[model samples]
Each structure stands twice: as C-alpha cells, then as structure tokens.
Target: MSIKINTYITILMLSSAAFISPLITKGQSTSLDSSQPETVVQKKYGLDPSKPLAKRIGNTPPEIIQKFRDAGMSPTLHRLSKTDSLKVVRAFQMLPPLHQHILKEHLLGISFLDNMPNTALTATVNPEDQFPVFTITFRAEILKQDVSQWLTEKEMSYFTKDFPGFRIAIEAGKLDAILYVLLHEATHVVDGSLGILAMDQNKGTSGMAVNLKSFTRNIWVDRTSICPSYTDSLTSQSRFRGGGRLLPMELARQIYQSAAKGPFVSLYATSSWHEDLAEYLTVTHFTKRLKQPFRIIIHEGRKEIFIYEPMKSATVSSRISLMKYFYAKAGSSVLYERHVKPGGRGFNG
Candidate 1:
C-alpha cells in the first residue's frame, strides 16, 4: 500500500510540473516597452542601483516606485477584492527581510488577472526594465476561490489533519497556502532576475540548454538528489500547480503512505529541481515560522495506515542549513534554531 502511494504521488508531482503554463502572458494586446534600457528603468522606478543582485541577495530595503497596482495589461480584468488585495500585500511583506528587499525593488509591479483560471499564477520580465523588472500576474479568482477542493482526496484528508486550520484559512483568505504559492512564484522572478537559474539558449536552434550552476544544481544534485523520473527532461518537470494527475482513491492512499518515507517535503516537491527548492523553502517557512505541522497519516477504517512527518525526513531536514544561508537573516536563522536542527552544511555551491 505504501509503495503504491509513493508511485502515484511521484507520478502526480512529475505530471504537475510538465504542464505549467508559460511565464509571461499578454492581455488586451499590450506590447512591452522594449526600447527602455536597464539603467533607465532602475532610475525611473527608484530601484537601488548600488545593490546588484547575483545569487545571494543580502538583507536590504529596496526603493520601489510602486508597491502593487493594476497591470493595465487588459481592460477585461477586474480589480481584486479589498480582503484579497490586503492578504496578498501582507503576504509579501511577511517575507523575511532579506527577501523583502529584493522583492520590493525588483518585483516591479503586481496585478490581478481574471482571465486565467484560479489555478494559474504567472510572472514575466517587464518590458520596461532591462534588469529583471518583474510584473507578477495572479489569477484574481484564486484569492476568493476555495482551491483546496481541487486537491486529491488523499491530499485533502492529509492536509485537514496535519494543518488544523487548513480549509478554514483558505476560506477566510488567510492560509499560508496562498502565501506559499506566492513565494514559490516569486522565487522564479528572483531566480531569473539574479541569474541564479538562467535559461540556457544557443545562437542557433538546438533548443535551450539546461544549466545547473546555481540553485538548480544545488537542489537537484547536492540536496535531495531528485529522482530521475521527475528530471529525465525539462518537459517532464513540474512546478507548484494546484492540480496534478488524479488516481483512484485507493491508489492515492497507497501513494501517500509510500511518500511518508521519502526525502521530499511534499509529493509535489519531486516534480523538478526548481519546484524542489521552492517547495522545501515554502514548507519550511510554513512549518517553522508559521507554526504549522506538515504530517501525513492514512487510516483504513480507524486502524492507522502510515505516518509521514516532513520535518523529520533525513533528506528534507538536511536542507534547513541551505535555507538558512539563502536568507541569512536573523529571523530565518532563529527559525532554524527553534524548529529545524541546530546546524548542517549550508548551500551546496
């Protein structure tokens, strides 16, 4: 039963990555301001030019012209509700100081997009800025929608038991799940902005190459050593989508049991290197900082089936050191000391 659960969870995670939508989607046919230069964008937006972003962005506040606003990309899209808007804004602010600085400045702008299904969250390199000015677009419906209903029965049951307020928080628009999704997508923006995970492209048409020099390699190889089934090719990889391949309820139960003994935080973490890093960081932040529990228990008519506590996984727990280095802030360090083990090796590279 446990082995079957592991197999299906693995399949669901990998499939979720394979079907992620494109990063940038245009609305109302709004073209980018490609003529704008990097320096000019920085100056115009009041972003800090002195502080350059490489891989490790230190803890510093950014000078941002705008915090959050409409994308002006489309007329069809409507404004987000006050509760939802405040929730999103507060979520960004809740990030550790180090990440707060990077996001405030480089994040550029955030807008609501109703065109996409609630399941979609997208980011794009703002055309107005040459140096990684990102405009994040969230499917507006997501904030008001009960996305948890989309989870598989096994996932639903596990979360309900593990995270006490899981469904209630989602309904009230206060769950870390929304914040987790935001942080995960925001990581991509930071990764692209800092060249931490650059897309390798050749001069001709051999298709883009995969480079693991930065965060990608650290997660795929140095950290968890992601299963080959998830990383055989870029096409097979998965991101942090709310949906994945569905399995029979019985099979789903088996998969969850098998996953309990695995190294990854959640089954979704096995989708790809990028997702692995994002999922690890998000879950750690949720469980450690937010005081939430990430455990899995299956029951067959009252008898215990299996139990999996993510924070206790040998492989998953080892990455706490890397998380500390990634943030390198007082709060994150303290969180690590309080929740995760005292120390381990920091970032792989």
Candidate 2:
C-alpha cells in the first residue's frame, strides 16, 4: 500500500492578535452612578481576544470554530477544552502566558476527546486560502495510558540509556503525557511554519505533501528536497505496532543500535525526517535543557539487562541544532528560553 508522505506523516506524527479603538457613546458615563441604581448591560461579541483568532481574522475554519464553541471554548480561537469545560480551561490557564499566546496564535483549536483514534496527540491541517489551520487533538485517558506503557522497563531500556525525569514529571503532574504530546506536535507546526520541514499542497487536492527543504543556517530552500528518501525510510520500517512499531527483542536491539549510530533522536524519529525533528525538539527540551532525568532500567529475573539515556547521543545533539534554526526564524522570545542552552545554541549544545 502506498501512502502519501505528507498526509501520512501528518496523521502518524505523535505527536493571534488584535487592536481596537472605541468611540464615545452619546450618553456614556465617565464615572459610576452610586445612588441612581446603575443598570449594567452586558454586550455580546463574536470574537474573543483570549481565545483563538476568528477565521475572518486568522483563517481558522468555521467548522473548527463551531467545534470549539460546542466544547465551550472559543469560536475563532486557538482554544483548548475537554468534555468537561472547566478543567481544560484551568489547565490551559496553568501554562505560561507566552506559551499560551504562542499556541493561540499558531494553532486553530485543541480538543480533548476521550475517543481519539490514533496517538494521544496528533495534528492535521485544514488548508485555508491565506494560512493553513492546524488543529491538535488529544485523548487524555488513552494518552496517559500510552505514555505509561511506552516507559515500561522493557520498552524504555531498548530505546535509550539517558534516563529522563519524564516518568517522575508525569507522576508529579508537572510533566503530563498530554503536555508532552502537545509539545511534540507543536514542534511539527513550528517546523512547517518556519519552512524547515516545508509542506506543499498536493496539486488539485486538499491534501498536504511533505516537501523536504534544505536546512542552512538562516533559511530553508527547496533545492534538493529529499521527499522520496524520507518516505522510503518510513515505509521500509516494520509496522508491528501501528505508529512507528516497537519490535521484538533481537530486532529491537539492532534497531536501537542502528538508531544510536544515526542522526535521529528517538526510535520513532527514524520513521521520517519530520519525526526526527519533532522528537529531537521534544526530547532535548524535556531532558537536557530542563535538567530532567529520562532514564530506563530493565531486569531479567534479577539481573538488569539494559538501560537507555537519550541525552548522551552526539547525533541527538546535532539534530537539536536544527531547532536553533527554527527558533531564530520564529523570532519568538519565549521559544528562545524554551529551547536555548546556557553557553551554546540549543539544548545542552
């Protein structure tokens, strides 16, 4: 079976502003009336500043707008919500203000449905006339379960030797599975936006196709786009598990060994360059820069067989440099702090 690389990568990846001026009303009061029983009339508006920008203003689709509204979030906003509205609102508020703004400006909407079909977090773009509308969806319950299962002694040890505080953060609620998924997916959006991993619209169709652009220091150019190389690599991999496949013991060891020798960040990253970039950003941001320990330990009847630590790979650090290119183009001050390392460019250099 053949899968369109751009659309397939999008499906499998696992992972705005305003101004105003007001005119004076004929009988507007400058001061509040204390004694005359002032009647406060509330006015209703179509768009919200705190929510995702409206399609008219930001090019988000009407259907997505309605979906968020039905979920009690925002109409044209990059809003977030779950089945229960209040919890999602509070969770959204818990994020840093700059983080929230970056998301709201770039994203169209976020929905926490309990019945998402794929990974805990996945992204899809609804192409628009002006700018593509990106929507990120999450299944909170399934996502938590996926993260727990992925970090098992058996699975973790085979992937890397760099122990991360990911499990600890999950337990403490400081680093949630949903949040991790969101960040990974968000990196994809940032990548596409920066033209680092450029996406081209399929001719005469509404679908998107991956356009692998060359990565220089400052700009992304489409000279020798390696579209086939990425797609071929992804398809050549075994699909024992749906997304990227977790292999059997011997094969898995060989795969991880090969990955360690490669420029990819994680096992899943080997699937495609897009994924390679996403995992690179996600793992580095959480593990090295954040000073978190993402360690893995495995035992066989009483003996420990293997352990994985992702941050120790030189190849992984090299992939992280690509993010410096991304951050520089995004020009977001928050992004710098999010990915920037102390003495070097990004994520422990």
| lDDT tens digits by residue: candidate 2, 1-349 | 1122123343332210111101101111111234321122111112233564222122343553444445444322233334334444434544333345445544555555433223433333422112223455554453343343433422443232333322111111244454456566666555432233332222211111122222221211221222432333432443411333434443443444555555545555544455566666666666655455554434444555555556677744654544444333344442423111111110100
After TM-score superposition, the amount by which residue 53's alpha carbon in candidate 2 deviates from its true location, in angstroms, is 11
**What overall lDDT goes with each candidate model?**
0.43, 0.38
Evaluated with lDDT, which candidate comes out highest?
Answer: 1
- Once fitted onto the true fold, the runs of candidate 1 whose alpha carbons sit more than 4 angstroms away are 1-19, 24-38, 43-76, 126-130, 145-176, 199-245, 297-306, 329-349
- The list of candidate 2 runs beyond 4 A from truth reads 1-8, 11-49, 52-102, 121-125, 142-174, 199-236, 240-246, 296-298, 325-349
Best by TM-score: 1
- Give the CA lDDT, 0 to 100, for residue 24 in model 2: 9
TM-score of each: 0.57, 0.54
**Model 2: how far is 213 from its true place, Å?**
7.5
**TM value for model 1:** 0.57
